[model samples]
Target: MEPLIKIEHMYKIYNPGDDEVRALDDVSMEIQRGELTAIIGHSGSGKSTLMNMLGCLDIPTSGKYFLNGKDVFSMTDNQLSDIRNQEIGFIFQGFNLIANLDALGNVELPLIYRGIDKKTRQELSREALRMVGLEPRIHHKPSEMSGGQQQRVAVARAIAAKPPIILADEPTGNLDSHSTEEILQILKGLHEAGRTVIIITHDPDIASQTDRVVQIKDGKIEKDYWNEKE
Candidate 1:
């Protein structure tokens, strides 16, 4: 089977020339469909740059990236936006929920952007909230909810469209221990349901939950291996 994602000799450099910094230096990797993986690295270790490349948020300075067999850089800006909406679901540690939008509204925003009709968006948003165990808080805004509840809302917003890949960046950075466990369990459930889940975290415990871990350091891949103990 073709790889779900493939990157060959990828390089992302900032301020190229006299004082250049390589965020990603020649990163070549292939991730299969339905694999639950974690990319672990501390700040300045290039994990964030790798995530940006994987999510197609920023184009690499050189090399190639293929998601689902299509060259990512070959697409136009609008096409890239469409691919981001349809192929990748992002869950950030910051939650990124709008203060004014209620949980259901937040979950529905992406669908709205995708031009989904109101009736279907409503149904899908409700289903997504239910999946995150936030059905009761559907009408509550971010200010009305606890941090964990707000993060759950974020997760709902990410998965509402059932995108092919769930790319999470430090998903537990802000929550308490209990909330972190809750979020981790939800992600695990998604993986169990056959979603391609990629978690970007510096926490070793968080990385231990995934089927595999790729460690990045100094703008290069330092390690890539399955976690047999996990």
Candidate 2:
């Protein structure tokens, strides 16, 4: 079977001259379906650029990205948007919840964008919240919740649509240790439940939890290896 994501000889260069910045330099890798992987790097180590490329939020300057065997660069803008909506769910470190919207409402936003019916979206949203242990806080706005609760709501929102891949960029960056563990457990559960979960972070502790770690530095992949967990 083909890998779910494949990139070959990829490069993302900015300015393209004497002062050009190569955010990604000849990077190449493949991610099989249902793998729990981590791409770790420091702040300027090109991990974010790679994340944007993986998420289909940005295109590389050169090279190929095949998502599910489809050439990503060949996609039109609308096609890219549709694929992003249907194939990957994103969880950001900031939670990114709307201050005015309650947990349920926030969780339903993506479904709404996907044109799901009100009744169905509400059902999915509630179920997602329940999965993240936020059933009781369904109607609470972001302002009324703790940071962990808000992040749980964000997780609910990301999973509400059942996207096959969960791309989390520093999902636990803003949380306390307790909250970080909570989020990590949730992500682990998601991985065990058959989703492809990819986490991008600078924290080795976070990377250790994943099955595979791909470390990036200076726009290159420094190491890629599987963790030996007993």
Model 1 TM-score (2 dp): 0.98
| Model 2 lDDT per residue over 76-126, tens place | 999999999999999999999988899999999999999999999999999
- Model 2 residue 51 distance off true place after TM-score fit, in angstroms: 0.4
Per-model lDDT: 0.96, 0.97
Off by over 4 Å in 2: none
TM-scores for candidates 1 onward, in order: 0.98, 0.99
- Candidate 1 per-residue C-alpha lDDT over 1-230 given as tens digits, one digit per residue, 9 for 90 to 100: 99999999999899999999999999999999999999999999999999998998999999999999999999999999998999999999899999999999999999999999999999999999999999998999999999999999999999999998999999999999999999999999999999999999999999998999999999999999999871
lDDT of 2 at 201: 99
Steric clash count of candidate 1: 0
Worst 10 residues of 2 by lDDT: 93-102
lDDT of 2 at 108: 97
Cα lDDT for residue 221, model 2?
96
In terms of lDDT, model 1 sits at: 0.96
